[model samples]
Target chain A: MAARLARAPGISLQHSIRHAAILLVAGRYRDTDRSALCRLHDQLPQPRATAWWGAAPLTDVHDPVTIAEGDDPVPQLRRLDRDLLRGARASEPDWLPDEPPNAWRGKGDHGQGGKGMMGGVPYGRPMAMMGEEMRDGLMLDAMTVTIGPFLRTLPPGLSLELTLQGDVIQQARVATPAYSASGIASEPLLRAARILELLGLPDLARRARISAARGDDDEGLVAAARRRGALLALPADLADVRARLDAALRRGAAPDPGEECLVDRLAGMEWQSALLRVASFDPATLSRIAPAAEPEEGEEEKAA
Target chain B: MTAADLAFYVLSAVAVVSGWRVFRTDSMVRASFLLMLSFIAVAAIMLMLAAPYIGMATVFMMAVEMMVMALFMVMFMMNPAGLNPMSMVHQNRLSIGAAATAFVGLTVAVLFTDLPHEKVARQAPVIRDLGHELLGPSMLVFESAGVTLLAAMVASVVLSARSGRFGPSDEGSRPPGLEPGGEPAGRVPESEQEDE
Candidate 1:
């Protein structure tokens, strides 16, 4: 469904909320995802509206624009965008409260809140502390961050806790496993298109999607992608990812599930490369490789 | 004051203020970019001073350097977005002392030193002269340095490749063969050939 939206004319899907003017909520979300969804809604800039496509509107949303299942959402989305811009439709209010997550507690002259240079939490969050480097022996600041349940790059509902040093991931743990794959999501052409998009070939990705929708073999699409150096854009070091991309382009069967843990595979890779590696796998294979870690106390309340 | 003099004063203020903000900004990424702005302002002043080549070169070089620096800052710094607002500097007192000393020394030199007052002729081909100066006698040195830098870039790429000449770098890697059920493409170690 998301892939179809990406292909729709005049409907560009944005990775960041800041870039988007309308929040399109499609498909069912978990009950726990409510706060996160609300946060996302609030992040969208002013003159924004929410269009629920085949999905129930959030309880907080006022007079939501709902699209029925089996109907094309493109027209409605375009109308909503147009209406909002024209000021004919009312802009949606923020679902979440406008307040800082932590209290400001600075005591110093510059509001540093700590003695000397690095003593206390300036706001509420503690400064990133040093950790033993993964690649080198030197100790460097390592940041542990929760990435997504809805990040465009990763599969839906797949959230990860990544400890990073420099751009490289020192460690990774799956906070939540990805939702089960729908038949359309597992299509080879769509999978290949996703990889092409990641490789910075959006035109080729669009062609691949069009071909998939038309039930075309897409031999020309594959050839065009190759001519454009789609394969070359990928790092040679990530030969596995390259192979998966090739296989997907050729409409080959999915790769046999490996015994290696997903977290182990991801560690030591830079963030971009790691995302590419993760995107290379089918959802079933990914779920097999990355079992969810036991949820920590109060972790449910935290949204990235 | 003349327009040129007024422009110079404004640019000087921008350079100094932005340079100071480089330290004051909580975000390391923002700091690197503020430093770039300061460099650009100084470059603009250099242009006003009639050194086009130096000014343009400063802008180009600082743009690239600051971009890389910003990337590094995002990669290494904790809370690179400054969501928590933390100090980026360490050994603050020592840094302040050194900076103050350098400022004083530079200010004294600018104020007291005997400086050339001769203005460059308005029609003088300054950039052309600089080009000749760089590419004439020191051409070989510059060319050699360029080649060496290129070589270093290639060497780094080769060294960082996960797959080595011998075989796959890890258990998961499966390098494709030239033909179906054939030996893998690229150079294979003699030991592997013997085992096969």
Candidate 2:
């Protein structure tokens, strides 16, 4: 369904909510994800509308545009976009309240807060504290952030609590396991296409997607990707990733699920590389490898 | 005032204001880019002062430098996007005093010093002259510096590589002992020692 949307000429799928005009809620979401969904809906820029594609609209959403299952959402999306621009349809109001998540509590007159520049939670969030880095043992500000469940880079429905210093992920903890992959979603062609998209080869990714949709075994797709230097684009040290990508393109059998935990493998890796490595695994394998922790109270876990 | 003189004043104001904003902005990324804008304004002033090569070079160099600086800021700084209004400045009294003194000293020097009045012809090959200056009299020095930079780049790449000539660079690789193999020198990680 996502591939069909991507193929549609008028409907451009955007990764960031800030760039998108319409919030397309697809697939089933857990009850716990309601707040996160509301947050995502609120994040879209003004003059926006929410369209539910084969998914139930949230109870709070007013006058929702719900597309029936097995129906193509492209035409409806186009109409929604056109109506938005023409002011024919009223824009959806923010689902979440327009207020800061945390209250301001600063010490000084100017709300300068904190002691000496490093010791305050100005807006309920603590400043990134200094911690020793893994590679060289340099003291750097390490930030803890919860990413995904909806972040386009990683597998859908997967969420991680990451401790980061610069671009490098110092530590990673799986907060939510990814959705179970349907047979179609786990197909090798689509899997290969996902990696190619991350590698910035959108043309090749499109070709792979088209091939999968057509149900035609295009042997030359892998060769063309190789010709475009896809393997070389990955870092040499990421040989495992390169091998997996090659195997994916050839529609090879799934690799043996490794003994090491996914979180352990992710640590000490740069964020982009770590995301790519995570994407290399099929969803079922990913869930098996990444032991999920119970979602902590107040942790923002977005709907996939 | 002539148009050029008017542009000079405007650019000078922009440069100074942006430079001031660099310290005032809460976001580290915004501060770096503000500094870049300040540099660009100064570069435009340089162009108006009839040094196109230097002006253009300054614009190019500062753009790249500030981009890198912004990347580092996003990586290292807390609250890089200025979501929460936070103060970027520090050392309030001392920094203010130092900045005021420097500004006064520079202003006094600018007002009193004998300044160069000579101007290069508009059609003169300033870039060519610069190229000649760098490659002729200072050829050896420039070439040596370039070579040194290249060497440093290569050495850093080699040192940072995870895979080495013998094996995985990070896997149980230890520095040799000062004497024989009494013990591997430096701080061996407790984890690696435990593995042994």
Candidate 3:
């Protein structure tokens, strides 16, 4: 009977993952306690990479280096890369660095970019010397590694926390950052609300977006619900929505009758097809926002 | 009173007291001690009956055996050497009922039995004559018994011990750097080592 009691896995008393993590590290607790803690830990949502330093392009000639390049005496940089691969291996796994590795060059203007890179620096080595104007042009051509590309595809408004087991992501904890008062897209609810609005749920989408735009992402569902109620209180119609979108799109310039007619025709199309059209616009829009410049000088060509 | 009767009464009293203590004591160690006492008492009682060969043997053998048992009780079961509660009888009412029934049945059988009162065939004590008898024709049997007992002791000690706390016997001479205390010089005590 004592043995039986000893063996019984106790119910989890730890309500939070933080506490469970503490228990896991301490490991002084009984099997019952540990079991409860483990269950609690497992129950915690997997974390997302809220912001990621995206993939660095690899290269053979100059190994990619990711560090700032100012002229001041550099403080000793901590060695971050453990067992960094010296050369290519026989069996190259997919997760391993890509072959014919595109060495990361700093953010450059589209097509003018020379190599694969994270942030603005070539990961491991300085760029080959180019003429002054060409160097500036090369610098401007390097790409900004946005975490947004991977993030945009995830289910919106899901709260996410991430953990890395070595280089690989071991766990992700999803939780809506609904309580942030900044109304920033950082919160899942506002982000979700924004996405919904971007997808064109005008009335439903506008409530959170307006609150978020007003920098109040902390607005609770009840307050958001109340705001939604108020919006609903307005005398709304399809014409009102079209009028509003037209007014917004027209702010920068006078409306072209031909473009307006095309917009109207597209607006009337099925929601599904419209969604595909909107998604198709993403790459072009992203490129427009953060343009990549073309490579200015070819080192090999110059040397020849 | 005869030595047998005196011994019987003393052992019976011990058995009853220890049996009572086994239930009364809250500590597991105490309860086990009481149990050991009872077994030893029973062995004594067995010796008291003209069963000298078995009786004295049982006393000497069981005493040594039970002392080792006491050491075990001190070592392994948590709070070794401390009086920790260890009541195996969890279902008190059920156990009481079962035990009472058994006691009553056994008491009735003992009280009603027509026990024989046998007369001794020998006038003198048996030990002297038995020794003579054994040395003459049964010396081999005596020697075999001694051998058997030696083997049993060796086996029991081996079985009870954990593997190799002594490690391997260093070659007849100590290995390169072992000191007089059979350990490396400047070695921290085991307790301190565990702390680090």
Please tell me which predicted candidate would have the highest DockQ against the true structure.
2
Candidate 3 per-residue lDDT, tens place, B1-196, comes to 9876877888899999998887776555666768878877887776555556666776677677667776665443432322222344578899889999999999999999998878545445777778897898899999999999999988976654433357422212222336565654433434546667
Q: List the lowest-lDDT window of 10 residues for candidate 1 chain B.
A: B166-175
True contacts kept of 3: 0.00
* Cα lDDT, model 3, residue A186: 25
Interface Cα root-mean-square deviation for all models: 4.9, 4.5, 32.6
Q: Candidate 1 lDDT, tens digit per residue, B85-132?
A: 556678989999999999999999999999999999888999788778
Candidate with better DockQ, 2 vs 3: 2
* Model 2 ranges off by over 4 Å: A7-9, A105-108, A111-116, A292-304, B14-42, B65-119, B129-196
Candidate 2, residues B1-196, lDDT tens digits: the string is: 9999899999999999999999888788889999999999999999887889899999999999999989878766766766456678889999999989999999999999999887778889988988898899989989999999999998987876755677556565576788897687765756678988
Off by over 4 Å in 1: A105-116, A182-186, A292-304, B4-51, B58-119, B127-196
Report the CAPRI category for model 1.
Answer: incorrect
What's the TM-score of chain A alone for every prediction? 0.89, 0.90, 0.17
Residue range A247-303, candidate 2, lDDT tens digits = 888878656647889999999999779888988886556767896444221211111
lDDT score of model 3?
Answer: 0.37
Candidate 1 iRMSD in angstroms? 4.9
- Give stretches of model 3 more than 4 Å off: A1-304, B1-11, B39-57, B81-84, B89-117, B121-123, B132-147, B150-196
In angstroms, give how far residue A283 of model 2 lies from its true place: 3.0
RMSD of candidates 1 onward, in order: 10.6, 6.5, 33.6
